[model samples]
Target: MRNVVLAHALARDLNVSAAVIAAFADAPNFHTAHRVRSSGSELLPGPGKPLITPLSYQSIIAMTQSLSRQASDWGDLAAWVNRKIEHVLLKPRHKLRNHI
Candidate 1:
């Protein structure tokens, strides 16, 4: 179950396709799985609620979009930091060489 969730999250973050995510999660019937509801409520009544409900397609898509945005933001931040670091480290060397 945790693996399925992680696979889904990674798929979102990495921009992987639904088929790939499903394969990674070992859920061959991924498309139909979400539509399935627990039948326990019908048979056992009251206390037999499902512990884990399947994620809807809309929720999955929303999650993927959110993760993609976050990844893009992080990538932008990393690029900015790399440029700053390069400027700081290289500028001093250039200054020292000029003074030499």
Candidate 2:
């Protein structure tokens, strides 16, 4: 699935260091969290700074699945949340973004 596609892409681009490829392929959020910390955090970090940990990865996956289930449970309430977001003070930004 996504892992296969990403590994295929990395293999095509980076010819050396299967360790690097495997690490990248395993945790998709490593790249994203790195980007955020490097730009948005108080301390800017290099890309090589280890952003992925066993606990953090577990938390990310757990939270993702939980949020997905919540959205499904909510049904059109998710849609309503998105529509009314701008009106609320300090709105819940983690609410789903329905692109449509």
Candidate 3:
């Protein structure tokens, strides 16, 4: 499932758990929510910032499963994911390359 794959990615990168992922997935936008704000992560969405949210669990599941089924190019997938998380997980250019 797409959510499962995403959950794994989030858990690995953000150091969270299944419950946390589920809670986040259940949110309206997965960012513009009180719980996400309280999460204290740089990934938090704020005014003027918006994030794509899956329309349904089934959709996410179908998406991720499709990726796997299609044997999607891992390099391309990694590039896409990097674009999404680098800003929130990695350090700024001036901070030196000591990844977070």
Q: Which residues of candidate 2, in runs, are more than 4 Å off?
A: 1-38, 42-47, 50-71, 74-77, 80-84, 89-100
lDDT of 1 by residue, 1-100 (tens): 5754665577669976322222111122332432343331122112653334445444454455577846665556545645544554455554633422
Which residue ranges in model 3 land beyond 4 Å of their true spot? 1-62, 66-69, 91-100
Name the candidate, 1 or 3, with the larger TM-score value: 1
What order do candidates take by TM-score, descending?
1, 3, 2
Q: Provide TM-scores for the models.
A: 0.25, 0.19, 0.23
CA lDDT, every model vs. true structure: 0.42, 0.38, 0.44
Model 2 lDDT vs. the true structure?
A: 0.38
The C-alpha local distance difference test score for the whole of candidate 3 amounts to: 0.44
Candidate that would win on lDDT = 3
Clashing pairs in 1: none
Write the residue-wise lDDT of candidate 2 on 1-100 in tens digits. Answer: 3654564467558953222211111122234435434553222123544222223333444455577856554555434443443334233434322211
lDDT minimum window of 10 residues, candidate 2:
17-26
lDDT of 1 at 91: 59
Q: Residues 1-100, candidate 3, lDDT per residue (tens digit)?
A: 4765675578669965432233222223234343545653333234543223323333444466567855455445545544544454444555523332
Off by over 4 Å in 1: 1-69, 94-100
